[model samples]
Target: MAQWNPSEEYIENTRLYKWMQKLGYSEYDLFHQQSINDVEWFWRRVEKELGIPWLNHYDRVLDVEKGIQWPKWYVNGKLNAYELALGQWAKDPIMTQKEALIWEGEDGEVRRYTFSSLATEVNKVAAGLKKLDVKRGDVVALYMPMIPETIMALMAVSKIGAIFTPVFSGYGQEAIATRIAASRAKLVITVDSSQRKGKEIMLKDELDKALLNCPEVESVVVVRRTKTKAVQLKEKHIAWEELLSHQPCLEIEPMNSDEPLMLLYTSGTTGKPKGTVHTHSGFPIKAGFDAGICMDLKRQDTLFWYTDMGWMMGPFLVYGGWVNGATIMLYEGSPDFPNADRLWQLIDRYHISHLGISPTLIRSLMRHGDNWLTQKLSSLRVIASTGEPWNDDAWYWLFEKVGKEKIPIFNYTGGTEIAGGILGNVLVRPIKVSMFNAALPGMSAYVADCWGNQMENQVGELVLTKPWVGMTNGFWEQPKRYLKTYWSRWPNMWIHGDWAITDEDGYWKITGRSDDIINVAGKRVGPSEVETILASHHYVHEAGAIGIPDHRKGDALICFAVLQESIEMTNTVKETLLDFLSVKLGKSLRPNDIHFISDLPKTKNGKVMRRLIKNAYLHLKLGDISSIENPNVLDEIAQLKRPGQKNL
Candidate 1:
């Protein structure tokens, strides 16, 4: 069969086609190389193409005086993110009246919003923040569910030039307080309670507890969402309704493009979480550019990404979709709620052109069977994936069952620090199962060996050679730490901690985190490399591979696998599994132990907590596990020790 390329709908009608004409480049490789080789001209054209306004034009596109560690973008340009995202579409009658926000709850509640109405609500929150003294450089935090108001609060905070950070709704007090205090945010937005999977999660109650430790928090804005009894309002607590009852300011503040916009705290291997800072021009512009070119999103499209407000995808979806003038769908509960068809229903109802989700979600749904995925989804032109690398079984299931093998899996990889993707599948190319077509146009990413030499076939570290828009300013108040984290590994290159490989066919695959590369015996292998081999088995749903110290071979591998439902692990079955893995990975690298479990520990964003597994196996202190979604599973894993193992 012939390979599929960018659809006619994209090449014929999208703004990318218009830009291709303007740049006089019909081929993607030529455009990609030019975008990197001439950074200044490329970004200037991109900003203009996106119709982003610059009250004061940039003196230059990039400034490297501070070196790549802190290269300034769009220097001297002044613009509002709200203005950038809204652009000329805010004035269009059809766009203003078009349904821009779609929301549904686990309890059968649904809400839709026109762009004008959404803007009004966002302005009301902005006005309220202004009234509460949330000034231009002040930080406001949101610990809320994936509700329309959650996104509105984010937009409103950006509208007034206040840096906003979001804590996951399911987080405990300690996790919430840690981020709120670290960012020193004065105002917080949250719901009194929220419903998820038919259960009530007390959001405002947890916020109040978190605030007790966060002396920086001066006030709270509460959304009354659940049917739980209303509690008495405290001195610092105010209702969302009360804030919106007042007249909205209806004005956006234009700030310098380089001004801070958000402070998201991501966990590190070291003890504490680092607060990553993103700027006004950086995150929004990069996100929009990725959505426009990679996802081929147009204003006529509707985007629905299964995510929580806490994850980067939440902000990525909102900023990326709107910044490109596409309608966005936000669901507030479990991806699998009353039934497994919930996600498909959203796609069907909203006519989602771009559907973003994680490979873990697909793996989880794959176990539930594809009976619910029977709905017609011709509108889904792109199946966007991130959070983690894909296993063959889950990748094939998603492509065949969900996308009907027609849509491309737009594999993307970057991090909160980048504010957008580094490597991603572009619309111009044909994706090979689970691979990135190329690095996003502007990023100069490459796979290199430990000594900084570029590698071929063999897996190596992923490095970005040139700085791009949306690279975080730095860890909040920790510039030295930021340099040591990303730039210290290599002289000038940004060592992005992830492991990757490029095949002879020019396809790229992010194997796993560089730090996560398990050195068993003498061969270094990424966890995903082994996990993928195991997950390909008919009985294995998902697998977590960890390296434990082996006095015999320097280090040995262990795999904790979540088997398919109703599958029993007999001795014969175990032997068969071990032999199968040996054939795929060779006897020298085959895992010493394979334990079956009900679930694997993961964060809300769906990344496996591999370190937790290693720590548990090594009998080391299990550090801050506040981000773990399923902590109980860790206890189950801790009980499974190899032969002759004592402490475990």
Candidate 2:
């Protein structure tokens, strides 16, 4: 059954509706069909509709002579990415005085900046970067938290035609060093300290340790977010205030449409992190399209996505919100700090219209109950979800309780390489509980078997047949590796490394990553099928399910569950959960054992790293442990498998 149905008024007010009308199409399916079939016509119209500020318009919208894997977008166009997102807005008389950024620190500190003020800060920092001899094409690394300076520095770097790579603030020294060395970053931007859970973390101190292995990094620019402790600065370190004190230079460097804008790295399940390259026109334009048209983000809206700058959504938040002339909100601390009502309080206080969150967060917040949501979210019209797939119970809670059954939860899923969403819920269509109603226009997505034949209702690999605007230019300095990873699988299809299914009504659902699937006897099962059942239990907070080798059935399923606070580990609790799983997921697919753990390894974005759990359980090498939020948690799993305990 559909959870939310769009009324005629709702459909008419959507940006998608207006764009479709401009294109002379009355039906969304027809528009979407032509969008992927006649690629040039569709994207050209999108550019005109978006009013992309081009110094020189493109001769061709797309070129595929190099093959579908390496298609070029906005061929020969000239425009700065910053101009599309914020530069043009700052120059508009009507938008200049409108709030562009609103930041709230963990310590109850608030700061707001208008478009004009933000432009001035960016201009000064750009001039300061020039003074430091940071030339065009130089790579800069930002290791700061979600503060105003972080956004300012990113825009400043792009305005000067330099590539900026953001590192996650929660990372330790090794992870920081790995990215800096891989990108060969020239300048590193960081904070002296950042607050989290009522404690101050020394960011500069960690970066200093990382810099020891990154001699290529010539200078460090420090943003002093908190002065609770004295920070010792080295000779190459520059204060953020000093950069802002420089004379403002309003000049914007004109860049080719394909010039590198940001180099984002993703720590895959194994091996070194892959650097996904995004161009000046690619990331921002696609992000803008996804945010503005698909989600109906508007100029009067305040958009807040709970994310760290280290991830794709961090940059997505900045470009997506600003490109549409919307106000972006940033919060520095944990969403559940002090009390479970923290997120609810912020939503009411800020009057946020469009909000983005992960399903993991919603599951974590479920324990707090509905009492925390005391205020009516009158201003919130849309709630967007990404990061991981949603279980039915969590999805229902978010829709029925948090949104009061009046708002639609836009289930969004894409990756760093895709820039934004490949599959998302469009406002023109009726939304189901946890499925994407449509593939975002311009994405030729389908579920297919190993031989590239399309399938329905049966689980298969999710593949894209055509190139889209925001597809990553290539992996930084690793073209062959990129081709081998995505395009090498099929003739012309981009194998997205995910397993998905499509229903008869054309809605899509992602089961899990292709590699995360488990084979038991002859049946194939995604780990989420098991984890979802475990998550439904009252005592369980979160769970990681993995398949291990078994002589009897080829593979045996095992689980690690984190119970709620003060819940004792007992045989009855395990038997009850085992009985629950047996009822929910049949006896044939029940987990062989459930090991209670304190925490599961996760990324800063709240995605549980199931592969790492499996690696530790099987005594395999835990490859690329850089992105995990808790590296120590792996030791606990390793201890469980040590010499004396009972084995599965």
Candidate 3:
């Protein structure tokens, strides 16, 4: 057992503890003791305490005879997420006219919608969808930017009990077509164009190209955004406003809790995206619970998360904030556009209370220095990070600059499958370097090695031992793939393919993906290990390392590095880095070669695309190059390849 106890000072000073006290818990000891000793009772109490409205009650709270295979939760219960998010709130006199969504575009355009107004818009869209012949279980593909209409469309689809599959606006036509076709979508909602970095992108044209390959799509609804010349509408194409002009704003169809709500795809090692299906009750409830208790969100709080509708974070952010009656802030542009301080300016202007971002963005801000971030972030109460593992330097910089080293940086980790974070850092926990203080309540997580044996203080695969409410039902149209990917490796555990370790302090640290682990001379070395070491170098701005097939060493560590402006790539510098690595991690773990480049390949959200780097090195045909932010970086790295060397 771990003797991990939070400091009294930290608990008393934290926003989470104060909220718990306001909720009637005088101390963390009482709350934790009650939570652990009676988990079912605690969850039941939470369901009631959080004011979750249910039309039908359950006979039993939990049924475990089926194990993870078919564990029934809230048996005999009937509650729809749509009702909990909009219906009850809309009925309440105090919350009816309150602002629920606040949206801002890249071109200084702003829009606000109240709870009642949002419900009206959602009902109109829902009626429009019904007129277009959409029915329960029918898939609706959303290929739009982060706009208010997108949120309305999501709620409209869920209200009518249809499954929504959102494709990122940054994705190319081919990627979009693949997802739409795979889901056999009956309709697609998009816009003529979208603004990003002060430029208008032709989104409808891209959708046109994608729809050519997706014949199952019966109709397309286009929203006017950039005031660009409209495309020639086909028999199936209709303007968004025209479609909903005469629709009523009071129609809503409730759904069962276990019905599919959304399908989010996760790119696998082979580049084939797996569609993860989340149920209505499983995801929305979990997201709201975590946002309310863990984030300590309030009605007056404004939550801003820089994300697209395609990512799981988008839905998580929407449900989490809306269910808590907090205002949701949506930004439709690049984070670094116009200036490096754009995000900061928005926070200051909007009085945002909670800010969620990735570590890569923070590191980029760190590269630009702290002059902009040093401004008064008085409205900011907490900072949250996800998507990729954060380095110590970035973590410290974020806590120092944005949070003043006093606020909690909730380092959370889960995936599209779980819908929300399985492990997270509560506000009362001590801040550490890239560590998750604890798993979410009712979740049981463990670290195990390759032999299925539990490990401690050693890196291993992260697994969930018990089934939770937020767990995905299965993959969309591919139940076998779901079983093979997560459940086949372990009898009853869900093995998330990531490398993690727990410290003696009971804090968990994630390295990189287990599939990305390098085998050098029969020894295992995670890419994060070498990348972390390389990031420690002052001259190295960013680095991504991968293992390539080597005739002599079996698999050798090949590193690609980006340099700072004042740093130059020279033979001496490379040797110095090699020597530094030798001194720090021993010569055996030293990188075989380090190639300096202008930038590392990344996704739009700033996650390093290491698979692309490995593919470039081996001269392999790059799959789904559409998701890369800088596809040219691969060609630039390819130019440095030696003659007759294998191309990744």
Instruction: List runs of model 3 lying over 4 Å from the truth.
Output: 1-39, 64-66, 516-648
Question: By descending lDDT, how would the candidates be arranged?
Answer: 2, 1, 3
Candidates in order have lDDT scores of 0.80, 0.87, 0.78
Candidate 2 lDDT, 147-257, residue by residue in tens: 999999999999999999998787666567878899999999999999999999888987898889998999999988898788887898999888878799788899999
lDDT of 3 at 648: 80
Our tally of clashes for model 2 stands at: 0
TM-score winner among the candidates?
Answer: 2
Model 1: ten consecutive residues of lowest lDDT? 517-526
Residue 234 Cα positional deviation in candidate 2, in Å, after optimal superposition: 0.9
TM-score of 2: 0.83
Best by lDDT: 2
lDDT, candidate 3, equals 0.78
Per-residue lDDT of 89 in model 1: 56
